[model samples]
Target chain A: MEEKLVSLPEAIRAHVSDGDCVVLGACLEAAIPFAATYEIIRQGKRGLDVAAPISDTSSDLLIGAGCVGQVTGAWVGNVSSGLGHNYRRAVEHGEPHALKIRDHSNLSFGMALLAAAYGMPYAPVRTLLGSDILTSNPEFRLAENPFSNGGEKTVLVPPLAPDVTILCVQRADVFGNCHFWGSSGVAAEAALAATSVVLLADEVVPPEVIASDPSRVLVPGYRVSAVCHVPAACHPAPMTGRWQRDSAFFDDYHKRTRERGGFLAWLDEWVLGLEDHDAYRTKLGASLEDLRIKGEALSAPANYAAH
Target chain B: MADYSTQELMIVAAAREIRDGEVIFVGMRLPIAAFGVARLTHAPNAVGLFECGIARYEPSAETLYTMADPANQLGAAWATGLLPMMTQLPAGRVDAGFIGGAEIDRFGNINTSYIGDFKAPKVKLPGSGGAADIAASAKRLLAIMNHEKRRLVERVGYITSPGFLDGGDGREKAGLVRGGPAAVITDRAILRPLGDSRELHLTSVHPGHSVEEIREHTGWALKTAPRVDETPPPSPAELDALHRVDHEGHWR
Candidate 1:
């Protein structure tokens, strides 16, 4: 039978099952596929694990909405600006999920996932050995130094292997061949390590174009199970260039989330009211343009010469 | 009196303290400029160790962007082999550490963790990234913060890093007596250890700032030097070095 190519949701639903570990490539309130993540959360799926470098709205939202059972990474922020109640409730109150490790151990996490994908017994990492992060997280244990010559040296780390990986990209082909201009190595590593890969992209370009420029082909067709070309799907929030996160909307969301009664009411308007990114953008009106301006402003300046 | 902008003043203050050949650990944003300024002026041999593992950074005329910026690595010499740069600080190799804080309490306990409440925070910031380690381990910790009422608070919302739990005795308890924060330089004034209390005493005020102004903004009882000296203005050379690295021209 030939392999299938479907939308992001379908691919996720097909691959992801109960008690399956998942890895996602996301950063701080930037570059995440909210549409797919929202669907995963909506299903109330249990045992859905995640290994991400940094957490933002998508990770927090999933954890908040009871989609994630276990998360192994660092940091979390809410869809509503600044509010961390949802995250606290999910982690502290909801399930009391295990924290795999603390501190941003990206290289360690990457190595572990790679080890799993390659069917290795263990992966060595130089991070978290001397720090308290190793001592704090029980899942990670110290191993005797393989290179010890008469000195006491040990390696400490936990193995990480995700069943599936989901990511959104600026451009891709029909097949799951995707391209990311910014910060490609970590994301690519995560995808390559996962058992299955699903990609969501802004637009589907010709395969020939991707093939001609092989360097641009971040992920090959063979690795990806599905490729969904959803323009502005990662909306209401920004997608680097297509759209930017509405700060005023976020401010209002933040205000509402401060109070319990106000939070539920705001959630009803923002989360429940919108069907998808299209609907969310409609409610946002022309403010999306302002968000674009804000995004440009944030990324453009490296340092403030005067204060 | 020195006529320098806030950023320039900070660079000048930070530059004066660094030695000729010292390993200075710098965080993103303002610290980069301070280190660059130091390099350009007083301490030309001063090696800048970025958190992103870039060591001995020598930026071009226009050095904007974060330390993790790919442009920072361009034509840069990597000391990865000699130092194992990433794990050096935790390994106790760094000499001096510089950090910025959102809020600092009377005891110098910083709170970049939570702005209001942890449960439903008003501002969820980038939590302590080696700040505690740097604070605890570095031979000398130099803090650079913009002077504001909100920042110099009586109590921090969250203790991102324990500065001085109680006072001088606190460091002994935390096992960081040998190396810890020595001086805190803000836009308004410079604070150093007062007496046996370990309480930060205002040693000097910036040219335009007054003793009353520092007292008014502080959340705790402000301490002062018996005789306050006006901070010397940034030299023309210092100003040139500072503006050289500011790619955005915001400092210009």
Candidate 2:
């Protein structure tokens, strides 16, 4: 079996080429690829299109670092932390770089990814008929559903296959069998739709442990290009079972990032200055201890002796 | 006597609007609290679904800032994937939903996307996170928002979520099979659509608020209901539940 483990920088460098369209996992902190996101920023990847059903801090920080030129997402807010400063600056003032925004509703965006995963030409969206999204994006078209009640109206959105997708999960075995629970937003679908995937996990367990509970694995190892053992991968966004969201951090971030100078100062100290995840952890210091929490095991390990 | 803050009253009013046993798809921020209040009170059986895949969730005593907060996801019966979870709304299983926005019009069109022009916005708010989907597909859409003319407007600059869509069968014409803005729940009063006209009319003013006050804040030439009633004050039980769900008053 190929060892899928690699450094976060190596994973990003290998799979994510410049100008690639990347969709970060944004199930509101469930599995945010923040470490990978920071690496992408540190590498100074540019002209990338950032997409999410809800682009929270992950997308906002990417925008802040001038790594993305376009955004294909529904919403880009800090969520519980007020508006995204970089997103606002990009949209309102066009600072850092001019942003090209392709609007999508939460369902339409997620469904498009699902369509791609299902290998469908386009997904029939039941909503957005009356919203400005149909008017704004020509790609989103209205087609009458021939099967439903003689020409029932529905919006047909084209499939979205991102160049790359990165997700942070609670655990993954050496071969990239990823396990995530709780509020899993389009992670599985996005994983399938992406041409390349980088899996960031809190820990990489032995392959036997992963095989023991096959049911717990959401993304199969074959689908993943690289797996990086990244603890606290979803920092500002909490990983389920591992940690609760640091509400105070979000509040502080909101205060810091509201202004451009403050935001840049933050970026310099936290993101740009850190060479790797270890450095980032060292900076986190004692707070990392506070973030740790234990939870009950989710699944039973099946015995191979019976088989 | 009800010991209620304006936020508490707002949450209670919004909660009371949700019918019992309705499948309520709740958006984050204020709507989460309203849905929590509903579940604690009259709408216990109502399904509290989030776009992030939490289903049949009961808000914990701990105040969570976002609907996607892990705390909010704790007691969920099943953490279904996004497709299955989000598809529930458009498949038309959703009876009601709670939504919020920056600006709204008389026809109930909402603008949470941008403040000014699309290309060059004056302010960029988070775009739709299942709000438009809920608005388009829910059998009845209850918008929970604060009362202010700037928010409740005559015409929104951008329409992120379509309500009745310029009124009078606009939603029907647009092929939204079910659901329109059933009511706008605000701190001041509850505004219901006027029959088929689709124009919002002041139905009930919250305790200590007036029809004139709701009218003063509404964007259009607001009309009063045939027999507008004073909204019942939040009961102690309701206030207690609200406080428990929103322990920190983050949204409160």
Candidate 3:
């Protein structure tokens, strides 16, 4: 097997191209690929299209950094703080330059990714009938159900295959078999739909460890282009069984990034100024220890004894 | 009856709409809080289906700031990708769903997309996450929002979720197979669509609120039910349940 392990910077540099449509794994607060997102911002990649089905904050940060020009998603905002300041500014005032938005509900967008993974042209859904989302986005169309009566209508969403997908998982092998628990979100479909996969793992386990429980592997090695072992990759965001969400950081981020100046200062302090994720980790320091998962609810071990 | 805050009243009212053993498609913020109350009190067997593809039998082990919070996944009954969980909505498996919007019309048509126009907006609110799907397909939909003239509008700027599109048989004509908005639970009062008109009318008022007060806050000339009962104040047990669910008071 080809050696897929690489440094975070090299993996990002080689796999991610300028203006590539990128999809980040996980929905809202679980296993967000923030390490890779910060790197992309530091690299100053522009005109990129970000797929944010239910953006937690990375999309907002990327937009704040002027890296993203287009966004396709249902929502982008801070869960606790309400609006995404940068995202709101970009759309309402064009502060970070105008952003093109193609709105979709969570199901429609996820189904689009699923369709792409299946190599289908479009996915038919039952939502978005009377909503303005159908009329506004040209990509979503209404059609009569072929097998049903002419009156039966459904919405057809075209496939959306991202150029690259970035995921942060609990563990993976050097050959890139990712194992993660908690809400999967649309990670599997997004990974399968993307042309290239950049996998970020908290631990790079041996191939034997991955083979121990085959069912836990959400994404196979054949689909992954690069595997970078980046501990604490999803800082601020929670990685189930690993750490808890740093609510203070998110609250502080919301407070600090409410305006253009605050956002820029925040971008400089957090992303551009830092050398790498290592420096970022160092800055995090004891807070990492504080946020570490304390309680345990271990799943019963499954038997895999072969005759 | 014990004194209760409007937030507490809203949570209990929303929870009351959910029957025992119902499968609820839970949304973010207040809906999650209400679901927790329902699970702990009236609806013990109620299963919450999150948009992140989690079927939770119990409330989060910890406080949840978001729908996809890691705590929500701790004791999930089933966990999978978003597609499967969301597919259950259109597949007619969901009994009821919860949604909140920036603006909602008398018909319960919600707008969470933009405040002004489709092409341009005065303010860009968070777009429909899974609300459109839930509103369109859930057996019955429950809407929760703050009671204000600006929020309870005559017509929304954009239809992010379908309710009774233009009232009478509107949802059916729109090709929606499931029941539309059954009730709108707010901090002040409960509103439900009435008669063949399907226009939302004041069904009940919370403890100190009156019909005139609700009308003053509503953008449209809201109709009143034949006998508008005062919404019961939250019981001690309900308040306790809510506090336990929202330990941090994030939603409260």
True contacts kept of each: 0.01, 0.83, 0.79
Across residues A60-93, which tens digit of lDDT does each residue of candidate 1 receive? 5565455666666544554335545555544344
Best by lDDT: 3
What class would a CAPRI assessor give candidate 2's docking? medium
- Candidate 3 global lDDT: 0.87
Residue B225 CA displacement from its true place in model 2, Å:
1.2
What does DockQ come to for candidate 2?
Answer: 0.76
Per-residue lDDT tens digits for candidate 3, residues A124-157, read 9898888889877888989889989666989999
Pairs with backbone N, CA or C atoms under 3 Å apart (clashes), candidate 2: none
Q: What's the DockQ for every one of the candidates?
A: 0.11, 0.76, 0.79
Model 2, A33-134: lDDT tens per residue?
A: 888889999999999988788746888888889999888978887887778988899888888878988899888998889899889999988878889878
The best candidate in terms of DockQ: 3
Candidate order by TM-score, decreasing, is 3, 2, 1
Off by over 4 Å in 3: B243-252
RMSD of 2: 1.9
lDDT of each prediction vs. the true structure? 0.61, 0.83, 0.87
